[model samples]
Target chain A: MHELTTTRNNYQIDPVLTVWGWEIPVYLFLGGMVAGMMIISGYFLFKGRQKEPTCSCFYVPWVSLILLSLGMFSLFLDLSHKVYVWRLYTTFKIASPMSWGAWILILVYPVIIANIFIRLPKFVTDKFPGLEKYSKMLTDRPRLIQNIGVANMILGALLGMYTGVLLSSLGARPLWNTSILWLLFLVSGLSGAAAFVHMVAKNIYERELLAKADNGFLTFEIFVIGLMFIGLATSTEVHQEAAQMLLSGSFAPVFWVFVVGIGIIIPLIIQLFAVNHKIQHTPVAPIMVIAGGLILRFVIVNAGQVSHYLNAHF
Target chain B: MARFAMVIDTKKCVGCMDCVVACKTENNVPEGYNRDWITQEAFGNFPNIQLEIRSERCNHCENSPCVSSCPTGASHYHDIGGVVLVNHDECIGCKACVASCPYDARFIHPDGYADKCTFCIHRVEKGDKPACVSVCPTNCMYFGDLEDPNSDVSKLLKSRKWHTLHPEAGTNPHVFYLT
Candidate 1:
């Protein structure tokens, strides 16, 4: 009997793709974090919370803008042909997730910049009086700020969902083929953002309110994750094997210990109690939620790449 | 329009690396990499075992995921034979094509572009067979337009019981292997 011994076959990295690395996960985490910030801050802005002295809605657009650019930078670094990156925008293939992401990110900048000018610091406007027109235009029209808020909400959801869609579109990678993956990533972003708002907001009332919201998001995020795994587990044998990697394979350790256990459940329980006033709020739980979001991205991207069609017994 | 496809006879294949070597030399494929490879599989236990060998590369599927997933339109079907080809100048090397390929046939070249079997279109255009089909000592390979009823590949596929890899993928791959 001839042994095909493909274990020695090392072509194009490996039979399993390692084409993507830390760059992808880092970009996804930052992109999701910023996407969450946009929605949370936009909701408050739409509600006119910007009028409050210490409302997070006023400054987070600025932070979101910075984080999103950094996320794009990491994505840029992943491109093997950096100079041809402009070609992505030259044509819009409606079916391609990367095309959708490229256009969405471009649109995000203008919306975020306009949002920042809504409550421009007086000193900066005073220094650059010519730039004051933006503040005048939006501040003069209360409806436009609300419209900006609406735009942010829609775009934020698209950005968050697209992060997962990027991976999900590759049906060859069985682990990421579920439609619910987009919703899972979006809900995770929302939960992480709520935790951030709860931890950073200066107003005690707003902090308490955001902590409650974080718990709701966390609960929902857990449900969505369950739906994703169930969808995978019930899929074709190829997909079932892919799901097994995270469920019981080598990835089980990280997926269970870091992502489900410490990253989600423990922080979720702590935040629930803190919101209920049973425990004083410490930075620990919120920090864990944020770090958990990061770890989740790493696990998903890495495990998804390792999962392939060949492992299926036909 | 001519639709190019390749047909290989697995029963006669000796698990030789000739096709892999010829492709590297003809395409100037980077060192330590190849566009084609040999796969040998055996079924049942030692005494009653049966072996199957295949020389494989890009299937150039009619419904190719690489072309559809490409954000830049860099991976496209050549108008000549609907053969899949990548434009190095336009490819951003995002690896979306690499990841989406069900067969894992494409790879990123060291020069930072998606690379795969072209079925040796350069030679086919010059009225010569693919480097692999030409170099095979056993004459186990055939290449021609499958659309033409009179072509060698078309006739061979018609007469012999053949199978394509990953039929479940629904890619409608052009490459076929005769049992």
Candidate 2:
């Protein structure tokens, strides 16, 4: 009899690569959610709804600022050298998606900050009497507000797509190498944003409209996921094996249960019924969608790391 | 103008891991980490099986993904022989290069920089071989300018059939193995 042996150093590469921890997924989820918020706020502003009392444009921009900061913080924590993060801004590598993201984030601050002034709350103006002039300056110029809307939408889409492209560009990881991943992330972000606005907007019309939009985006999200799997299944054998991780492998349960069932399908069904007025609209559906979006990020990031180019051990 | 390349004669390798230890000692690599290692692969039925042992490290590929993916230009080609190296001060410890490498040749240094084999660029500038190639006792490794047809590494490739680690990756890896 003969024995065969293999060694995979733990401190080195192993059954799989696990360089990213919870931080990446948390950052990805928050970034995507913020992307969705920007698009929703931009769309509302373009329609000249900033004057309306229930318009979420006023709240979303400010909220997005805080949420994005949190997300960026998580991303910063993931860095091996946190102090040198400033180095990312020094030069732009056209081949690097992370560079695009850093620059996009820089643009996000000014645009979202400008949006907050379009409908600066009276309480804030009252506290800082000197700020009234800038608020009036922005609110008086509808055309300027509309331009910021276009900028937000454009930047929003870029931010959303950048999250997915970030993963897809690393062709070394078989699970993230699909062409459809960008669209999937963008749609998921849009869906999450729609659900959030539907939950928070006080106007009956706005809530109903956002509910309808949320349903549409969720349905599109399901389709995009199907296409992503189809693309993966048809790729090389290694890619197909990589897809197996999310399908029937160890990650299958979380993928099918938390992400697909509770996170997506149930919320999707609830929103569909609420949009149709077959059931009363509740916050449950939107919350589910948000949570599902987060879980999806976790599952994909973890599974992608486990899906090796040379071996499908996990 | 020297495109430095490495040629490993697998049949001559003993998988002693002298190369891994030498890299640690020479580079002062962090504890529980190394810049190179040995791999043993076997094929065929038990009695007729063929065992191939390889001492592997960073390929320092021509189309290096790690360099291209680095947002801060920390991972760049050195002047001596286009050897890939990470400037410790410039690296942000993002690990994007680590993920981009198909060979999994990198790890995060305890000091927060992406760490990997540099082909001993520091020593090479002084006209010394890489730690691994220099310490290899079995004489299974060779390093020289592949662009120079007269070089020993290039001559070995011309005389013997060789294969790279992941040609389909399109990395244009500079390392080759003689089976």
Candidate 3:
């Protein structure tokens, strides 16, 4: 009863901008968080201040491995040829940032895994049974793990800054070609790590200790967020367009609702108002901090990817 | 010693995508992928319309960003001829070159190495024209050695005004388009 209508294809589609996608930003966030966790754990270990061995020594490495694995997997998934991904290491083009990142991941992952193995309770217990009781006794002593912590810190810092430098080196993408992007990434990474640790600590530690760490992480997050914003705002037009996309363009709602609202504002306010007077045992602050950190990565990744190179306006 | 280059006349191009199809077929370009393409910019939405067409591929720049961004040294510009090629064995499928390229020309091949228009170096080495040049129905595309003053390309360069895309990138691209 109805005449079939074949619609003419009037609109032409430009080749989609396919360079950096959700993976790059997410990788940056994950790498930064790992670096942050390593630094925090390393600092605490070196100080011999073992407030909670399970949280710092055990959980940090485990989480780092998990995040690292996930980040690397995301990178591979984004590759057009997933099967030959290993060839990237051998290709060794000095001009390519992706090649550098691949090599860095190869080196960093092994070191982090080894560090985790050394701290695992079972490994320590089985390898040196004689030191078991002494090791348990030494858990609370911050001085015992200080060296490991320092190593972690150094490694973590490199991991954090690499994400920023990687993007900045692409001068063609005016949006990412800036030195400040590195600093912003570094600071945000540390904040994300602190938030992660605070969350983990909340679940493992007693109320009082959890509250203190949450407060510390929340304050640190606010400071870093401010720095990131300032860095983004001061950049050149190309970078400004990227920032504007987050602030008001297609990426605005997610940027504001998730990155700024849930990731920064909500967690900050909860820590400042709702939990400030509460006893240290509450789980809310830590949970909020973790939620905010993840959301921050999501919004940033999406925002950075929405712009195109072909547009005259860009 | 062999410096490869291409000159395209914008006026002669009819937006028929002959070069695109020819390059794809010659190079065995995978389905849903393109190594060379024609871009058309049409003005005046309705009734009164004018269109400008551009044929684009890897410019084989002197300062190729794809080469520098590849961590594995898989992508490199040949020092002798300045033709960019990928060393497939060394590439790790990282896509760094793809991101760094301003023209969006390089792509990850199915084998995991970066791939782009090599200016048909294989055919050139055999003293034959590139597939696109030989097949172009309108004779819109020109290829030759830029170094030899007697070459047709060199003669064209001397006589015609031409421009390269994203000259601000400082890549010193070999491909020139005459308006």
Query: Interface RMSD for every prediction, one decimal?
Result: 2.6, 2.9, 9.5
Clashing residue pairs for model 2: none
Give the per-residue Cα lDDT of candidate 2 at A155.
88
Model 2 stretches astray by more than 4 angstroms: A1-12, A312-314
By the lDDT metric, which is better: model 2 or model 3? 2
**Candidate with maximal DockQ:** 1
Better of 1 and 2 by DockQ: 1
Ranking by lDDT: 2, 1, 3
Write candidate 2's Cα lDDT for B1-179 as tens digits: 89999999998999998888898999999887767877777767768988888888889999998998898999999887889999998999889999899888899888889999999888888899988999889899999998899999989999998999878888999989999
Candidate 3's C-alpha runs over 4 A off are A1-14, A18-26, A50-55, A88-94, A109-119, A127-145, A202-237, A278-281, B42-51, B110-113
Q: Give the Å shift of residue A308 in candidate 1.
A: 0.7
The TM-scores of all predictions, comma-separated, are 0.97, 0.97, 0.82
Please list the C-alpha lDDT of all candidates, in the order they appear.
Answer: 0.87, 0.88, 0.67
Task: Please provide, for model 2 over A1-314, each residue's C-alpha lDDT reduced to its tens digit, 9 standing for 90 to 100.
Answer: 23334443636356568889999998888888889989989999999988797788989998789989999999999998988999999999999999889999999999999889886788998899888899889888999999988888988899999999999998888899898888988888888888888988888888998899988898889898888889999898779988888989899999999988988899999988888889999999999999999999999998888776676322
| Candidate 3 lDDT tens digits, A151-217 | 7777777777787788778766655665666665666676666666665564344233434554565
Better of 2 and 3 by DockQ: 2
Native RMSD of candidate 3 (Å): 5.8
True interface contacts reproduced by each model, as a fraction? 0.58, 0.57, 0.45
* Per-residue lDDT of B23 in model 1: 91
RMSD of each: 1.7, 1.8, 5.8
